[model samples]
Target: MQEFREILVAITNAHTSKAELAQAITLAADNQAELTFVSIVQPAWFENPLLSRDDFQSFWDEHLLAIAQPAMDAGITVTTRQICGHPFHEVIRLVETEGYDLVVKLAEPSGVFNRRQLTGNDLNLLRRCPCPVWMMQDKDAEQPAQAPVILVALDTSTDTPEQIALNRKLLASADHLALQEKASLHVLHVWDLYGEDRLQGPFINMSREQVNELLKETESTNRDRINTLVTTNGIGDAAQCHLVRGRASHEIQKLAASLKTDLIIMGTAGRTGLAAFVVGNTAENVFAGVDCSILAIKPDGKKHQAVSNETDANK
Candidate 1:
């Protein structure tokens, strides 16, 4: 609902169903957000680098152009571009240069073991996309014609004032959808003492009373934060929070699957450099590993105001 003037949809040479195309186009039109259609054509040199150019290259371009035509005719201002390079790098560059508010991409097909696996290219973008990324399932690939139940994943470590504000806004949007689809909103907070904090060994040494006390404190804090968020934002009573103990990503993935959620809304810190690349953040770790669709929201730029204030005061 925030004013998003520019959005991008990344496509490929592969065929897309009309429903998928219309969904993307209609969502942009409804939000009054501009749409850019990008398709990366993998060069012939890679698979059979020895293959003749005229035969394979021409066919690739023509195929992509034909695929983009439907989106162009939908009256949803479309910008089409084909890039020849690493799909993830070009996709990242497009997002950086173009300054898209969101990137929409189709969810990869489900394999026997994995429900749906994100391509390495998609994985890279999901980890470091400049904006939130929406992985649309084939059935729900296009815009939701009605209101959608916004399922927000909340946890202790990533809790912040800005994140609460964003979740509040998302919940408000879901409230509107509730009137139409009668959508229900569910907030999930996963608290595992043995999670990435890596305290399982130490915690196991503690007495039963000590462990129960620790979990009690964690649950209390989780509930207090949820209460503060709901009370401050005046989120509807219908929105409820579920607290579970387990690995953060695995617990969240399980909750989303069990709830049959329409969307999984979670926050990311967008951490980079040695700290993150070497040891990934919870959001990044979860994005790649999640089965359900993910809407990863990076903390707003204003979250750094505290650091700026401290620096100025010190100076």
Candidate 2:
């Protein structure tokens, strides 16, 4: 819906998610978009450090070509790429510089290691990458394995407008799928004041009036923004707003579980460096907290600013 004319699929030879790849292909074909298959090769220093640089490059190129073969066989307009350095960084760099409307990659599995728990490379990419990321874990499955259902998760965050806009665009895709399977479009927003108040600090006994005021004022406004967004965009009926209260990610996880959503559409500002190392982003937290499939949108920094400027001009 947002002119996804160019798509980038990040893959690896080692157990790449076929379901995600199939999904990416389906999205591209549906939109008549071109696809670029990108695979990053960690230099095989173990093979031979003394190997010629050209030889190493050739090996990398061949590996990406091999990975690209499957998509090509499916009649996808595919291009192969090989890059050095960290996998996530390379992927993000490609998405931003190449102007890809969407990025499709495998979802990293959980129950693995400690470092990955807080912020793995992929999760970090989801936060900072300037495009949307679709993480797939199962390659053998189709993306819309059973008629695609679009679920958009909303919250009291600064990026909610972009998230809502993205959801509307994805709904267009769902509309396309509606012809095949009954596609349900849902917008979910969660609130957890008790849980969040605990994070605010140790119990400083607050009055019922105070609590009510906060919920009524701030929380109510947050819900209002969500309502305004959906209404303005005509994304769904007002009933589609599934509002709840709890721990942010936990609430979303519960709702996603209850809804059995096929895809969770959300946005993140992939943060890194000392600030992130100290306090991680919610997008990364959501990744660790949920089992449902996700499509993560990252800020391009200027995307919002540019949109605001155009809005002012039109006004």
What is residue 69's positional error in candidate 2, in angstroms? Answer: 3.6
What does candidate 2's lDDT look like per residue over 28-88, in tens digits?
7777788888776454542576887878777767776777677678788888775554566
Model 2: how far residue 9 lies from native, Å: 1.2
What ranges in model 1 sit over 4 Å off? 13-22, 45-62, 107-115, 137-148, 157-182, 194-207, 274-291, 302-315
> Which whole-number lDDT from 0 to 100 does residue 308 have in model 1?
15
Q: Candidate 2 lDDT (Cα, whole model)?
A: 0.62
Measure candidate 2: CA RMSD. 7.7
Error of 1 at 27 (Å): 2.1
Each model's TM-score, in the order given? 0.73, 0.74
Q: Cα-based RMSD of the predictions, in order?
A: 7.7, 7.7
The whole-model lDDT of each prediction reads 0.62, 0.62
lDDT of model 1, residue 194:
50
